[model samples]
Target: MGKLKSYQKQFQTLLDKGIDNAEIRHKRMVTRPFDFAEKLEKEAKSYSFKSVRQAHNQYAKSLYSSLRTLNERANGYAADLIARIDKEAAAAGAKSGNSKQPAKKTSTRRSTTAKKTASSQSSRGTASTSTASA
Candidate 1:
């Protein structure tokens, strides 16, 4: 046994209300950052930037857009690869992902023979078991 942990009632109440870990962190991230306009202006000037914070804002938007574009490209590539694989598989005689190859006529005949043999063996087993038990 371990010592019982205690907490503030409000913390417990928040837990009971179904707030999760990421939700708490997301709430924190979404909250306003410190207003560092003066510092930002100085830093931007030191780095030979014009219109303080303008470059940063543009960079953020550009990066975000590029990331979305990359994701779309990736999605398109995946779709293309899947189509190629499907075409290759069809060329190799596989019908669908789930469907197995249709059995050859000769194989179907052999399978039926195997099933009949199994059934006969099972019947023999039952007969022998009954004779021994009797």
Candidate 2:
């Protein structure tokens, strides 16, 4: 938190807001765990333990997906900040005539899991986490 630039400050605020929203949403989603547990218990006994476990896993996945997305958004912002800082440092060095090396191209390659998570979240209509355009 040492002398953050304007954009970095904005990004930090966005990240904090997004994370807080995600946490609140998750809390709302899980406020009645006993209800969910009773609902599952009321289901047909034919539901094997494995099946119930799988169902629980799916529910957990949905519950945690928003948190994961928030983390990824923060990581993306951090990466962008690093790139900006590197670019500014390079410009300063060039101005001082000490280094002639060009800044490395920023690769936009994304993680496969991130793409899948984003697409799945989009399909589920939950991609309004404001990863960009904050």
Candidate 3:
């Protein structure tokens, strides 16, 4: 169980790092300054024609796809880990022996206290009668 917990924590850390990396890469790719020096060169015409906005969009799409893949992988890993943990727990429970049998049901015998109380109340006649509903 301890090992399983450790594995789960490690998986969570990996997922967190993946998310952070994706965010950092996305920010870096999208926020870069446009290169004005490339405009003067004839050979840079094809690349220069592509606007920063278009480049940013492309990078964003790529990042989104990669992040989605990462998330899917993480989900699969987490699921497998949970399943393994459950299997281990079930095996442990089985090994400890099935001593958890249902408790014996004792018969609920009615007591004669109600009858005794009623007889005593009757003997107290007038007091009991005075309190009775009309």
Runs of candidate 3 exceeding 4 Å displacement: 1-50, 98-134
Tens digit of per-residue lDDT, candidate 1, span 1-134: 13333456656877866667768877777664534666666665667545546877999999999999999999999999999998988767654456576767998887777666666766777545433433
lDDT of 3: 0.74
Assess every candidate by TM-score.
Answer: 0.33, 0.33, 0.38
lDDT of 2 by residue, 23-46 (tens): 999989887996788786788576
Model 3 per-residue lDDT tens digits across residues 1-134: 99999999999999999999999998787664434444446455656555856888999999999999999999999999999999998888889885467655542222354445556777787446533421
Shift in Å, residue 21, candidate 1: 47
Which candidate achieves the best lDDT against the true structure? 2
Question: Residue 94 of model 2: what lDDT?
Answer: 88
Q: Give candidate 1's total backbone clashes.
A: 0
Model 2 residue 79 lDDT score = 100
Q: What are the RMSDs of all candidates, in order?
A: 20.6, 30.3, 21.1
TM-score of 2: 0.33
